[model samples]
Target chain A: MSRALLEVHGISVVFGGLRAVDDVSFEIHDREILGLLGPNGAGKTTCFNAISGVYPPTLGDILLDGARTNGAPPHGMARLGVGRTFQIVRPFSGLSVRENVIVALGGPRYRGNLLRSLTSWRKKGIADEAGAILDRVGLLDVADRTSGQLPIGSLRRVEIARALALSPRLLLLDESFSGLRSTEIAQIEELIRSIREDGVSVLLIEHNMKVAMGLSDRVVVLDHGRKLAEGKPSEVASNQAVIEAYLGRGERGNVA
Target chain B: MDYFATVATLIVIQAIAACGLNVIVGYAGQISLGHAAFFGIGAYASAMLTTKAGLTFWQALPAALLITMLLGFLLGLPSLRVREDFLAITTIGINFIVEAVFIYTPFFGGALGIGGIPRVVVMGGRLGNNQFLALCLVFLVLSLALCRQFARAWAGLACFAVREDETAASSMGISPVRAKLSAFVLGTGMAGLAGTLYAHYARFISAGDFGFPVSISIMSMVVLGGMGTLFGPLLGAMIIGILPEIFRPLIDYRMFIYSVLLLLMIRFQPGGLLGDSSLVVGLLKSLKKLVKPKNIANPREIGGDGDV
Candidate 1:
């Protein structure tokens, strides 16, 4: 893949009188972890949604590996190696741990459909690949159990596993750390390092400033659907606009 | 004795049919009210092949399966974009369209219906009613096992995840629309199997038999059984399938009691019987039983109650 796996340029989304995300442009370099940060309603999610194809921009383009993938659906993007995890982890609750990954691992890129896949099993090493994916997710232990029975933290990891099984070039994590205990958050942080270390470009949106600041190679801050600051975490953390956005006009110094 | 055996067999057959419906309604949380249409398609496919081709019943069975599967896949097209009430409307519409086709088409015998359906014979000779019933029971067991497997398998889990949260499931690379449609097609295909069996066993078929009431009855079975459990559909089908017959002495009042029972079941147990029995619930219940309760309640554990 190219060094810049995804180049999201000039993207904009408007809601009546409000601009949810305006002229947001960012490049996700290959094998790097970038963080998007904003307070509640900062258009961080709207921007993520646009990139993920949940919301096609009211304006502008997104290039996946230098090809315009602007209006592609999630399935198409997934097929092209763009995988994502939800802020609220969605493990097909009724499904066992393995099937969650199986769909992504068995998409058009892998097993495809029923008839073709029936033959794929006999071809060579397909079962081993599926087993490998389950093992990678740490879900191999609960591979037989219903994913729904899991607590929120484990479901979050399942979401990551299912995404990873897609064999993505770019992984977008939406609040991957939200709602987890510190120990659970630590496990995810470690997993994120390993995943980024494996050459997948990651765009993570997080409200937990410490986690975002700690892990991000670079952090971008937004306010009222507009980019307020984008730079190294230390620099963005100290920026006047970002400080104002987080702490309001006169309280910027107090925030530190 | 014959009546008992037949009821038992019919209960198993309908239970299998209801199990398919339950996959869509119960596990995936989509309501499919036109399931009878799939059943009808299967029945017609089997009937046509046996009569027109002079094929043995066994030979016709697979043809019936394939045709109904095609019908199911086609009927499933509308579900690719809709769910809940809209999906129900589409299925209901398909049922009526298929029913109209059945009642009017010269090929399907119009209102005169089709007959002379050769009895299903498993071992070269015509199966006695009891022997035929055993085969149906075997199919029922296979169907039930298939349902349970899918319900708990990745396919079933995707349905539940989508049912619980569409956005989250999609983010995990599972398109909700695609997952639901697959479930709908598979569920309808099973309904076709049920219809094929019914046609051969009954030796005659009519459009009027596979109508809206039957669809409602199937939905009633899934809801009555519990929306997302292995035993729910079976239990739901048996109760709905046999209760009216049991109360036949009440004449027209049999249906009235059945309706009241359905209403009470929904109100008292919204998730159906097996709905509340989640793993967490089972574990917690067991844990609670093992511990003695103390009277002191902590007020500080409240979360977000004060937020307006």
Candidate 2:
């Protein structure tokens, strides 16, 4: 097995009196595709938030390449090579599709120094880089269109393109398949496979069981803020606890 | 000609300041209701340095700009903790506090403003009204170029990203706090530049000159011209700055008409006159259609408008 790229060591996130994620732990090896599955409100996104540095976990540590990085700011996490897509897609709506990707492409360089950013004449290089990423995600055709006017499928691709611009070692995709047509879903799955082939690890939160099962090498199921099952896709699908957590105990007794 | 030149000079100066404000309000998506405070600071800094410290106008200009920018940085620090309406309210408070400081501080002349500000001496003689207008025109051009550069550069893109979605921007490796701070510092520094020019040109200064009303007027220029676009604020300043002089015959009703016009603009064209969906764009599009050949089709139309 490849060395672990990310290790979530018993993290808990509390919101007021509610423990959104409680003592949940998992690991993703380098070049691995790990599916994070849960029912609605099962703390999957909360876990993503914690790992991506949106908020610090109330307890435990998140090690990225063996370095403790629990409470770093989101941009700091991105600088550390952690890219992410939101559940509801966010594109710089007023900007062109190419410009949205360009913003992400130039983020790290321009975020710190104002004078260098203002005087820099790297427009041609950045535009070429953005075009390459957009072409990778098959959005090169409508690269000049305003992002706000794009449909759901294209918007999702834009989000992915923006994330890819970060050159992340770990990609966190939150519900990228939701609201996409089957054809789009297949295209996205192909893209994810290619991303893994490029040696980038992926942590995907997916509700489409078949796609998730086929795509991920390992699957971790979360039920009520706890890790219910973590193993190979086939093994976790057949686990009795996971079945009960999904279908409830009264209906699926002894079925697996 | 003299009246026209003076009005034009004031319009150009206001436009420079409005362009600065647009960097914050239009591009970066932050509100600053206390911009006049920075302007006042610049004016007073230049005034005190030249009058009391016996420094040349050239020497004081850079000092005033740096002082205003440093204060702008301090002002931007609090913006990270507050957002939107709260940020607007905090800026309003800053305006009031700064005004109080100006009115009460002994060094700032305590309500009786400093006077006898030295004029820009080119070679041997002081600049005339016409020459001064020419100088202001040059600054206006520089301000516009600066704004254009910012809009196209990496920092500008970061500002737009932060404006669109802060969380999404951060996840993409852009720091929201830094983006906001840069906007604030640049915007306030521009306002200070305008203030410096105003003090020297008018050869007088006062707290009432940089009051809340002046702040509102600058904001209205940006909003009326179209907030985010390059030429919008300039157009806004020209119209707003000249309207009072145009309506001088009915001076009492001038403000009423101005208020009515702004109300109508907000109601009918919230995007301002130069925004993407503004009337100007619509008119230009129709004009293009009218001038185009009837037989030839637009390539973009053949491509089905680039929609899904």
Candidate 3:
């Protein structure tokens, strides 16, 4: 495997008295798809939040390409090539889908510059580039549609497309497959594979086991804010600790 | 014709100010109830500079804008931490404090206000009211064009994104502070410019002219006009500014009627006059249905209108 693109070492997140994520560590290599799997309240989203800089870790280090970035703001993280999607999709609802992508495209580079923002219209090929990105995510048809009116499936694609606009090295998707139908999941799974092929590493928090296991190169399981197991999909899925935590003690014996 | 020109002048001035406030409150989603304070600052700054500092009207205009923008940046600093309701309260406090200073401080002429301000001297001659009205119209045109450029630019997009969701905006690499500050500066600066014009045109000013009520009226113009739309504030200013002349008999109940109108607007049409979801659209749709039931029944016709 290539040198780690993202490394979370001994990270812990505490909210009030509760330790939402405790002493979690993981590595995501270049051009890799790593699945972060856990049941509800198992710290999956919390871990994604910490890595994406939404919630800074209370303990340990987050290294992106070997630079320590524990408490960098989310925009700073984006500049460092970290992109994320919300669990509940956040589309700039008032804007057109294309405008939403354009905002993300210009964000890390052109923010706070009145002159650049003004001349951004004449910038060569921005619209075409935004259009190409929308096409890649299969949202070209709805490029001009108001983002607020888009259905959940299209909104999910918009979120991913917006993330892709960052040209991120590491994409943290919080439940990208959640609430998606099996057919839609298959389509997004294909898109994720294509993204990996394009050299973007992905760290996905997924609840859909079939899609997660099928798509991930490797898997890490979290149980009650702690790492339960980690390995290849088959190995991690067969781990007794993971089965017990996910299936409960009474139903553990029936795990496939 | 004279009366018409005077009313047009007021509308144009109010529209310029409303456009400025629209950036802060309408686009950036920051509530500022004290915009009139910046307007006063411009007026007073121009008055003080022209009379006290011995500068020309044109020179004082830019100077007043610069001063107001500096003040806006200072005001925007506290906004980096506070948001929404708290920010609104802070601005209201600023308005009251500035008004108090203008009313009580002898330097600002206390209740008597500033007077003897010279008329706008255009091309080495004092401009008549009509010519002055033309100047305001030119400024209004320029401001509207600048605002349109802003709305079409990435800066405006960033503001909209921040207003919608700060966290999402940040994740996309847009800084909320920078976006909000830009909006605040631009908005307040425009208000200051309007104040400069108001001072030179009115040729007499008092703190009463730019008190809390003026701020409320300005905000109402933006709200009633359409918060983020390019023509919304202009439309709103015209309606608010002219309504008084049209209903001169009930002039005493003017503010009361406006308050009730605002209440109705918020309850039924929060988007305001030119907002996408404005009551005007609803009324148009109903009127369309009344005119041509066939068009109302045809989804394709609705789609065609949307395309347009």
Candidate 4:
């Protein structure tokens, strides 16, 4: 196989004495969807944070498209086409919905000449660009509304939309379907699938098994910060160790 | 007429200075109570350069801006480590330090301050009040235009993003430090520019002119006029800078009234007069209703009130 779009190799994150993410390894290829599944305290979010550069891994390397990106800051991750959503959605509350997306779009454009960036008044195109992203996320109707006024469902979509505005080659979605209704989750599933169809790789951290099993091309299970299993969704879901780890080696309780 | 013109000139100068404070306080969401220190730096720099070094007004203006901006950058470096309440206290300390340096140091004429700041002359003729007011207005318009341009620029958006949330801004590839420092350099430089204009226009200066109270007043302009709005600071400068003079008979109660107005503004309308609050929209809607002919109503709007 060709090179993976994102590679996590022997990554371990230590918070004081406790290893938050212990020797986790994974590889996500181009246009692929990899579901990261674990119960609470499984270190899924920790792994995501390490990968997205909120905090660096204590050991091992993160490779984005064959380039070593270990220890890069969040802004550096963004510049390298790695976009992510917060698990606990952080929208720019003071800004309008469209302005949120526009601010995200400003990420790469910040590299422009200082004087040119200041004096150039050709902001004529940025609104249209933000509008287009909002349209894709079905937020175009409420584009003028303040982001803080939106319901949780719409705010989740706005978070995704803002991440997409980065024009990322790889998108890291942290609990995108959490706190969403069934219908909202279904819509987000479709959106995630469509994002993958658009040639953007997805690394999804999900507690919901149905969406994870149905949507991810591959699944990696984490148990106490260790990689419990990794394979095709069906294979990993049926693995005896995975089943035991999830259901405590008792009756075959429903995963969902 | 001369008195009115002088007040107008002072308002214009304060408006320019207020715009600088607005960028740090409003757009970048940073606290700066020592803004008048930058203004003092500019005024002192221009005054000394003109009187001691014999540089012309134009030459001294740029030098003053550069010197003040450098100081602003240096001062901004330490503030970056702290935020909000701590930052405010740090700026207050800076204001006191600048005041003491001017008062105790004889290089800047001690407490008396440098005098005889040469008048801005064109074609070898001293400018009259009208001409000088016209000059200040030109600079005011240029400064306002610069601010408007910065607000719409990518850099400005980054500042806004940083102001909203630093982590989120960084995730979107904006360096919060760079955005904040840029705000300080630009905003403080503008304050310095305003100082240069004030020195030349007033034809005299003293350390007492730019002190802690002046910094508070400048901040009050940004807060009262509406932080974050383009024209809010200018509107604030007019209200706080000139309105008090209008009620000069109640000079003892000026600060008290300002305190009441600001308190009411913060309590009822945190966004300021023209801030991003819906109060302005509601007020405008009411004004529009008051102005329009009540008989001529749109058919589609009969049952549909546009209130959100």
Question: Which candidate wins on TM-score?
Answer: 2
| Candidate 3 deviation (Cα RMSD) | 3.7
Residue range A1-256, candidate 4, lDDT tens digits: 4569999999999999999899999999999999999878989999998988999999999998888998899888988898899889899888889988988886566555787568443456778888999998899999989898999999999999989999999999999998999999988899998998899999999989999999999999999999999999999988887887777754565443
Q: In terms of docking quality, how is candidate 1 classified?
A: incorrect
Error of 1 at A101 (Å): 5.3
> How would you encode candidate 1's per-residue C-alpha lDDT over A45-156 as one tens digit per residue?
8888888888798898999889998787766777788888877666666666766666566555432354443333323454456667767656677776888898787788
Alpha-carbon runs more than 4 Å astray in model 2: A120-122, A251-256, B291-308
Q: Candidate order by TM-score, highest to lowest?
A: 2, 3, 4, 1
Interface root mean square deviation for model 1, in Å? 4.7
Most accurate candidate by DockQ: 3
Instruction: Pick the winner on DockQ between candidates 2 and 4.
Output: 2
lDDT tens readout by residue for model 2, A1-256: 7999999999999999999999998999999999999888899999999999999999999999999999899999999999999999988999999989988788666656767788543446788889999999999999999999999999999999999999999999999999999999999999999999999999999999999999999999998999999999999988989888887766545543
lDDT, candidate 4, at A138: 91
lDDT of 1 by residue, B42-67 (tens): 88889888987888888988888888
Better of 2 and 3 by TM-score: 2
lDDT of 4 by residue, B1-308 (tens): 89888999999999999999999999899999999999999999999999999999989989999999999999999896688999999999999999899999999899788888889988899899989999999999999998898998878888888898888888987778888999889999999999999999888898989999999899989988899999999989998877778788999898889889889888988888878664876799889989985767766677676762
* lDDT score for candidate 4 against the true structure: 0.89
Q: Write the per-residue lDDT of candidate 2 for residues B117-213, one digit (tens) a residue.
A: 9998777788999999999899889999998999889888888899999999999898899888888899999999998888887888988999987
Q: Alpha-carbon error at B109 in model 3, in Å?
A: 2.9
